[model samples]
Each structure stands twice: as structure tokens, then as C-alpha cells.
Target: MDTILGVSKLSSKFQVTIPKDVREILKVSPGDRIVFIHEEGKIIIKKA
Candidate 1:
């Protein structure tokens, strides 16, 4: 369950691709909703 993916590139639209390990860790799939919140200077990412 451990893997790493490097950033390929960023498109002109400001969209960045999520690494495979991160995606799996977050249990994110296509069309899945994710929420980002800021707490105590840290970013919290959660699945919605």
C-alpha cells in the first residue's frame, strides 16, 4: 500500500494530477468529492 508518483507537469488550467499513492491513501476514485479545510495552519483533506 506504499507507492510514490512524481509530478509529470501542470497544465495551463492550473490543474495538477494527484499521485497514485496519495489517491489510494485518500481512497479517492473518479468523480469522488474531496474537501479542503484549513486548521491551525495545516491543511486538512477529507473525502466527502
Candidate 2:
């Protein structure tokens, strides 16, 4: 089953830091590209 890793708030500049657990799960690192998808009133992020 899926589980919630953590939560983050948007900064003044409209940026957010990915939680460590999520990043580890996604296997992303610095300089990697991430894609954002908008569907059904929800936003999804995926590694590109």
C-alpha cells in the first residue's frame, strides 16, 4: 500500500522541497529533471 512520506509548504518564491522519503523512493537527485502533470484537479510530479 502507498503511504504518506511527509509534507512541505510552498515558499514565497513558489518553490517547494521534496521530502527526503519521497525523493529516495523516486530515486531523484540534484540536477535531475522533473515533470509536472495536471489532471482532474491534481498535480503529479515525475522524473523526466
Candidate 3:
């Protein structure tokens, strides 16, 4: 599988928009739940 990298800015409301490339690669859609894991000083996001 190809790796995709994208950058997004966090909003004042503490919301961030997932980049299009990532969304497509992860096959995530609107209303889908995502999980964030904090490890080794980094955050990992996965489809839930």
C-alpha cells in the first residue's frame, strides 16, 4: 500500500478537517468515527 501524507490546520473550535487524500485512503466518510491514540509523543488516528 502506498503511504499518504497530508497537513491540516486546527480550527479555533478545536476541530480539524481530515485531508482529502487521507480520507480517501482510509475510506472514511462523513459521520464515521475515528480514534486517536497518543503514543511516544505522537498521535495516531485510525478509523473506528
The lDDT leader among the candidates is 2
Clashes of each: 0, 0, 0
Candidate 2 vs candidate 3: which has greater TM-score? Answer: 3
Candidate 2 Cα RMSD (Å): 1.8
Model 3 CA deviation exceeding 4 Å by range: 1-4
Query: Residue 12 deviation, candidate 1, in Å?
Result: 2.9
lDDT of 1 at 48: 88
Most TM-score-accurate candidate: 3
Q: Which portions of model 2 show Cα errors greater than 4 Å?
A: none
What's the C-alpha lDDT at position 39 in model 1?
A: 92
| Candidate 1 per-residue C-alpha lDDT over 1-48 given as tens digits, one digit per residue, 9 for 90 to 100 | 833455547889977777787788899999999898999997666888
* lDDT tens readout by residue for model 3, 1-48: 835587788899999999988898789999999999999997888999
In candidate 3, which residue pairs clash? Answer: none
> Rank by TM-score, descending?
3, 2, 1
Model 2, range 7-29, lDDT digits (tens) per residue? 99999999999999989988999
Sequence-dependent TM-score of model 2: 0.81
- Residue 45 accuracy (lDDT) in model 2: 84
Assess every candidate by TM-score: 0.65, 0.81, 0.82
